[model samples]
Target: MSHVGKSKILFVDDEEVICSMAAEFLEMQGFIVDTYEDSREAFDAFCRDPDDFDIVITDQVMPKMTGIELLKNIIGIRSAIPRILCTGFSEELNHKDEKEVGIDAFFMKPYRFDDLIGQIKKLV
Candidate 1:
């Protein structure tokens, strides 16, 4: 499937392999995807210039900062931007975290590529 508008997406993960794979998949699905290995840079991009992306998908377990922290800071700057927190945790645990951040979605790591695409589609 292809997108109708320019739905820019940012994928943040400390792991290059995971980000690379996901980035490629998202691009193939017709979204403008950018991958970042550093959470700090991703945070800066989202906070400083949220107009650059339509949605953000970030991994939870990172080196310097957690995804929740990054999302928190970004939400402070741009409260309207949509966000997705991707983690290895179950949906039950994610639900507890959801109350605070108000994310557009919570995606588990190793998630199905098609399912991820579906989530993005719903948001965009």
Candidate 2:
């Protein structure tokens, strides 16, 4: 599935491979994707221009800050922006109430790009 407009996305993952692959896939689907391996840098970029992104997809595990921390910062800046938390660890989801934390969607790692696209479509 492909999106029509170029909806800008902030995608954060500690893994370089994941960031590169996701960026390529999302760009192919007609979305403008900005990827970051460092959560702090991603948060800084978001702060620089909060309105620049329509969606934020981040991995739970990261170096400086966890995805939850990054999402919380983003939410404080732009509460309405759609946020998706992706993680390989089930324990991460178990520890927090996603709705309460302002997450729009939760995706497991090793997910299909089509599924991710579907979520983006629904949220956007």
Candidate 3:
């Protein structure tokens, strides 16, 4: 299966290395991924064309905006866009309940690339 409709994935994280790693792995899986070190910049890219992405994966602990904050912003614009929230703050996040937060999926940090690929595939 060619990841046609499932290609465009956005990865947002404060850490440059994590962003690069995710981008590299996801891209290798035939996904069109763009990574950003800041939510503001990522938001700007998304604002240019929100519909370009099929799925979004963001880290939880960022400088200005956390993953939950990012998710809220994205949902405001594109409600139905599937999202995967990856975080180390899972233990402290009140929105861990997917039903309450309306998240499509959640992946804890240090997650395996293959697992992420599979989950994203299922979501899309």
Point to the candidate with the largest lDDT: 2
Off by over 4 Å in 2: 1-4, 94-97
1 versus 3: better lDDT goes to:
3
* Model 1 pairs whose backbones collide: none
RMSD each, Å: 3.0, 2.6, 2.4
lDDT of 1: 0.80
Local distance difference test scores for all models: 0.80, 0.88, 0.82
Model 1 agreement with the true structure over 1-124: per-residue lDDT tens digits:
2245458888898988988898888888888888899999888777666777888898888888778888888887777777888888563345555667888887777889889889988887
Worst 10 residues of 1 by lDDT: 89-98
Q: Could you tell me how far off, in angstroms, the CA of residue 62 lies in candidate 3 after the best superposition?
A: 0.6
Instruction: Give candidate 3's TM-score.
Output: 0.89
Q: Which candidate number would show the highest TM-score if scored against the true structure?
A: 2
Selected candidate, larger lDDT, 2 vs 3: 2
Measured against the true structure, the TM-scores of the candidates, in listed sequence, are 0.86, 0.92, 0.89
Residue lDDT tens for model 2, 1-124: 1245579999999999999999999989889999999999999999999988899999988888988888888888888898999999978664555665687888887899999999998888
lDDT of 3 by residue, 1-124 (tens): 2256447988898999888888888878778888999998898898899988888888878888777878888888988888888887667577444554487888888889899999998987
